[model samples]
Target: MPRTNLNDILIFMAVVDAGSFIAGGEALGLSRSAAGKAVIRLEDRLGARLLNRTTRTLSLTDEGRVFYDRGLQILASVDEAEASVAGQSGMPRGILRLTAPDAFGRLVILPLLEEYLRAWPDIQVEMSFTDRVADIVEEGFDLAIRIGATASDTRLVSRAIAAYRTRLCATPSYLAERGEPRDIADLAAHDCLIFASRTRRHGWRFRGKGSSWIKAQGRSRLRLDSGEAIRDAALAGLGIALLPDFLVADDLAAGRLRHVLPDLETDDAKIIMLYPDKHLLEPRIHRFVDLMVEALGRERPDARSSP
Candidate 1:
């Protein structure tokens, strides 16, 4: 094998991680042509095609996968070494890529990020706000903030930053027109604005008469993927919606929306931050997550539902 260039290896890794030569090149301050040529040079040196690339998508071949894994190991080792040397003055100074649920990210995460950016003058942030779950490793995200989500990935670390409660709510007009649902069974008569995806299912869990948890779903005619859309539908008198208190707290207080079953306890909405497993944490990720914990790690009195 020819002597490998460290820069070429890094460019190759970036292209693979980004799933595009253009994006990878942009990250390294290189042109797309330069990035493509570098990867080609790397493959020639190794005497094998590493990437299975089409016009629309780029994927790693079997050899590329093995090589990428080894690259990650090397990068981890380098990161550890750098952290030890800069332990005292280790300030976060990079573009931190984060993914979060849209409504929560806008209402909550964005504020915390504002403070983070102001505090760390050198750090830049890129945020992706969507309801869709992003693969932390495959997508190369530094962190992800998820609401009421549970993860089963061993390569990631999940931490609970805060907790909230869900509220079944509707406008006064809707309540007047359809009449209030007296019990869970009566919910079948009312229009329920459901937040769910095409693949995943959703059910509203409540504490019934015996203080036992029971799962029930109202009749859902309007189903939407966005939490804000669900809230909007409820406000428009379209249906009753089960939503996190954070999204409905303001409306509930302003009397625009009334809590439907305030006495029936609902499941806790957990706010979790997820990140890749690493021996030494990146300063940018650690700082941002710490800020989120500090900002949201408290009981919200205003969000409490009243019957």
Candidate 2:
């Protein structure tokens, strides 16, 4: 077999990462035809197909997935080598892969990202925004922003970059129709919007009568995975929702949603940055994490400062 060209491999990786040939080509300064031909040449050299392509979508085949995973390992090694050589002058160049929850990523992370990009003009970022909990190591993410950090995973290290509180809130119209819930037990009588996922479920918890934390039991006739959707439901007079204050603060201020059970204190949500344990962390990842803590920890008003 002929020796594989590194440039061809890079082009293939770019195509896989960008999800389309045109966009991949755009990222690497290559024409669509040139990028397509480069991938074809790579596949021919390896005698294996990498991507499964259709008119509307593109996916990695089984072999492609394996190759992509190994490619990430190779890229990490390259990054590590580059970091060693560049030392203090690295300046956080190259693409930084990051993941965050959809609503928070958009509202909070994007603003910090704008500043990070402006300050570090040499660096590029690729972000995945979704509500699903991502497997950081398996997914090859350099950093992940998650709420409610317990740091159970031994393979990863987590740091609390910022904090936030959750609030039980409902629209005034809904409260008027259903009657206000004065205490924790009253929640059982009203419709509650739940945030649930395959692996996780959200329940309302507050500082109990005597200071111990207690979970509020409520009927979840309506449930949704997205935080923004849950807030919308509460705003539309569907039900009361327990949501992060950052999500509902504007609504509460605007009188679209009224805070419920203000006397009982709900648990604060910790905004955590999780990354795999590494002997030598890349400068890009280190700088980005610092940027998050600096920007979100101080600039974000919704971030829990005291608690």
Candidate 3:
């Protein structure tokens, strides 16, 4: 059989990485039509549809996913070959695609990204910041920073980066008006702001008597999907909220919000990083992961209290 054109595979991978034919083609100094044709040619040769294209979005079919994974392996091999030469292995270059939780991305990851970018001038970054869980492999992300979550997919690798304490808090006025909860059971009478989405709902858990953890029974009248929104709601006196210390430390320190059950222990919000399982990661990915682990591997006291 005639050998498949390797250039077509490269174009296909670029399109998947860039999420659009136009951008992918630009990366390869080709026009959108050229890139689209190349992908079509690749699909034709494989006798399988690789991409599900629409006016606004592009997604991979199951066959496309398999092909894409193989393409990544091929690229990794190429990168490794180049790295074996002198000076190529040390300099990290290329786009690092990342997805992270919204508030944590803004408050935590952004600063780390600044440092990472400064350290490696050749590296470029693209970020998707949202509270919704992302399918890292399917969505074409190189890395994902998640809070209170772990990777369940066998195709991904999970690493713990940091842990932040969480607290139940309310505006002083809200607590004054609604009365502070004396115990976990008393929370049932107070309005609670909950973090919820179609995919997941965060429930508050506190240390119960004798080393047991009990779920809070607070009435959930207001449900928000964003951590910042929950913090804002608590500040607006809309309801009591359970939030990470990194998010609410300033409010608590400034007396804008009062901690409820301050003596009660809540589970630490574990910050984890997830990435595709690969034997040899690209240098850009390896460097950024190293920076994140170096910066956030230990619990920070400043994250728990106001600066």
Candidate 4:
């Protein structure tokens, strides 16, 4: 077997992504002929036809699609290796890609971007906000902020960024009209707004002084996937909402929403950060993780708040 090198895979991935030898050549600073030769060399070494090319366009063969996918992984590993060595200089630079939930990103991370970008001028960040779990490594994201149980994948590393608790809250007027539930069983009589993503199948969970928890069943009048909408619904007296404490800190203080089951306790959900594990930690990823931790910590309840 001919020992394939990083350049071959890089050129292969570029061509696969760009859809033509000319575009790949332009991207990699090689001539169109050179890029074409590189792909041929890769296919020859692998004993497989990687692409079907015509004068107009290039398309991957069945084997080509499989190889293209693997080649992308190889190129990413090479990039991470190079970045790790470069990161030893004690400065983070270049593009840092991240993904997170939409509402969480907008309400939480977006607010910290100004300070984060100013603090690290060399680091350019591209953030994608979505509710779906992203393929961080395959899609080329440096990090992801996920709110629920971290799925076990050997390709990625996970870390807990912070712990967050859920609140069963409603507008003061709504609570007055619906009447506050004194026990877990009473939740069945009130209308509950369920967060489509995090709520348990059984019901809402509550936490108390010693971290004791009690899950309760409720009738969901409105079911929403977005945290912001659920919060808004609660504010409008639509229903009792099981919301994250971070999402409604202002509302609780301003008397817009009142807590219902302070006496009953539930399990606290975790906020986590995830990244690919195959390569060494680069400066950009390290710096971004540090920045995220600092930002979340600064917003903790004990931290000084606006007076």
For each of the candidates, the C-alpha root-mean-square deviation to the true structure, in angstroms, is 7.7, 5.6, 7.4, 7.4
Taking all chains together, the TM-score of candidate 3 against the true structure is 0.72
- Point out where model 2 deviates above 4 Å: 5-75, 84-89, 298-307
TM-score of each: 0.71, 0.77, 0.72, 0.66
Pick the winner on TM-score between candidates 1 and 4.
1
Quote the positional error of residue 83 for candidate 2 in Å: 2.3
Say which candidate scores most in TM-score: 2
| Candidate rank order under TM-score | 2, 3, 1, 4
Q: Candidate 4, TM-score vs. the true structure?
A: 0.66
Candidate closer to the true structure by TM-score (higher is better), 2 or 4: 2
Q: lDDT for every model? A: 0.83, 0.83, 0.85, 0.76
> Which structure among the candidates has the greatest lDDT?
3
For residues 132-189, could you state the per-residue lDDT of candidate 2 as single tens digits? 8888889878888888744377677777767788888999999899999878899999
Candidate 1, residue 274: Cα displacement in angstroms equals: 0.6
**Candidate 1 residue-wise lDDT, 1-307, digit = tens:** 4588889999999998788999999989999999999999999989889999898999999999999878876775665466667763477766688998899999988888888999999676789999887788898788888777563777777777688888989999999989998888788888998878865556788887778888775788888988999999999999999899889999999999999977878888888788887766777777787778778895322121100
Q: What's the count of clashing pairs in each model shown?
A: 0, 1, 0, 6
Residue 142, candidate 1: C-alpha displacement in angstroms: 0.8
User: Candidates ranked by lDDT, best first?
Assistant: 3, 2, 1, 4
